[model samples]
Target: MLKRLLPVSLLVSLTALGLAQPGGLTQTLLPYTLQLNPEQFEQQGLALAQEAAQLAQFDQIELALPRAQLAVQLAPQSAKVWSLLGSLYLQKNDLDQGITALQKARLLDPKSASVLFALGSAYFQKAKYTQAVDYLQAGLKLKPNIPGALFDLGNAYYMQKRFQEAIAQYEKAIKQDANFWPAINNIGLIHYEQGEIDAAIRQWRTAISLDAKAAEPQLALAVALYTKGDREQGLALGEAALKLDSRYADLKFLKENLWGERLLKDTKRFIATPRIQASLVRTPQPLLPRTAP
Candidate 1:
């Protein structure tokens, strides 16, 4: 974790004492002069950056963005502020802007693993698998135990069809954080793509056991079961999965999650069932959040 900075609410205004008009009548006021020293500006920027991070934690990124943007302007040399701006942009789905800010942060602090990880995520969002892999691997080398960065590295490898390496990274992530269900769920994805349905099902089952509310594994398990002739259970689970998050109902979204063709074909059929379709219609889904790497 990084050091915390609180928001600043400081202004130094020149004193307006008794200056009278030519008629000796008291003037309402004199023009105010405000100025901030270098340290003051830096503190203000750190303050705004802190506010942005707090808002992002609450998923209030739309309101956090401008503060982060101004933070960077006020403290352009501060790697942390630039990184915060980049993360805010990423949350807003602004990959190019995020990448730019992350790149600047990297230049400011080349050894920052978090900034490198952020750059990797931005590149991944832009579909630049090689760049994503480079950045993620670099970040992992700097901070080896970051499970999220390891999972992100695995995703980059998966995108490049480097399945063995991807699974190795995923396995490493699971080792680092035993309850990291996303890594386990992703291993299932790779197994399914490699035609090992049983293995994939086991992995998804384990992931679901770890976090029953996770929609990805639930949906994957549903599709696999459906294709394996467990129609009733599959349909029921699929409906439940969609009710949890309807975006999984879209093939395009599945593809974005790195679902390969074989699993996708099965998922297409699973979601096409009248039951899942009806569930999607009445799911009451809200806006999509930033998906995990």
Candidate 2:
């Protein structure tokens, strides 16, 4: 669930306003000067693309999609428009469309690291690990210090069961961005998967310390602590994690997020506790009767 952070709206808003001017020329009053008009359609398309990017940043995928699509239509040659559209499609969970859009962007701007990174991420989502590796490596070659790219390359490696390679990439990501809690949390996941429970716990603890409000690390540490007989604190952490993000409380959501089997089982048991059940606002459905054997 790595995502781009939403930036303050003021900058993008001003940029959009500037680009949205139909004439593509701004008259200057101070010096009594005027500039020649630029390409009007391209400017408008770029503005729409920027608007879509900002909306997507704020998790307004539904609203962003139309604007992104319109930008692509208006400026088919613009690499930025296609890249934004691809990212919007990915956020909207339309992997096929995302792949198409990102591929188009790559074709238009073969040297763009952002486009390569987006395509790699899209391939990862679609379970095309080899393609993910290729594109991610290509992106890293162009922009070696991009922590997001490094983090995702780690994930691609992890999925392929290349544990040491995954750890190396995660470590590189941490070096580039010390506060990147996701990479730290994912390193914990690898440790847990390898039966290095104590190491995993340590990584999770570090992740929680770095980002107190992060739900994933909190939930993971809770599960680890509960299994180690630290019941009270573990339960509290679990509740806090759920409070931070209710989606973590959903069974199906946990599976989709790639929770390990053991973690998922423990989480199910933890959530079934009377205290946790009482705190949940959603009611459980009635169970069907078992048929006679």
Q: Pick by lDDT: which candidate is best?
A: 1
Please provide, for model 2 over 1-293, each residue's C-alpha lDDT reduced to its tens digit, 9 standing for 90 to 100. Answer: 32222222422433464633323233442222223243655677788899988888887889998888777755789988999999888877799999899999989999999999988988988899999999999999999999999998998898888989999999999999999988998899888877787999999999999999988889888888888899999888888887777667777776556566767787898888887777566533325322110
lDDT of 1 by residue, 116-223 (tens): 999998898899999999999899889999999999999899989999999999999999999999999999999999999999999999999999899899999999
Worst 10 residues of 2 by lDDT: 2-11
Model 1, CA-based lDDT:
0.84
**Residue 270 CA displacement from its true place in model 2, Å:** 2.6
Question: In candidate 2, which residue pairs get closer than 3 Å at backbone N, Cα or C atoms, i.e. clash?
Answer: none
Please give each candidate's TM-score: 0.84, 0.77
**For this target, which candidate reaches the highest TM-score against the unseen true structure?**
1
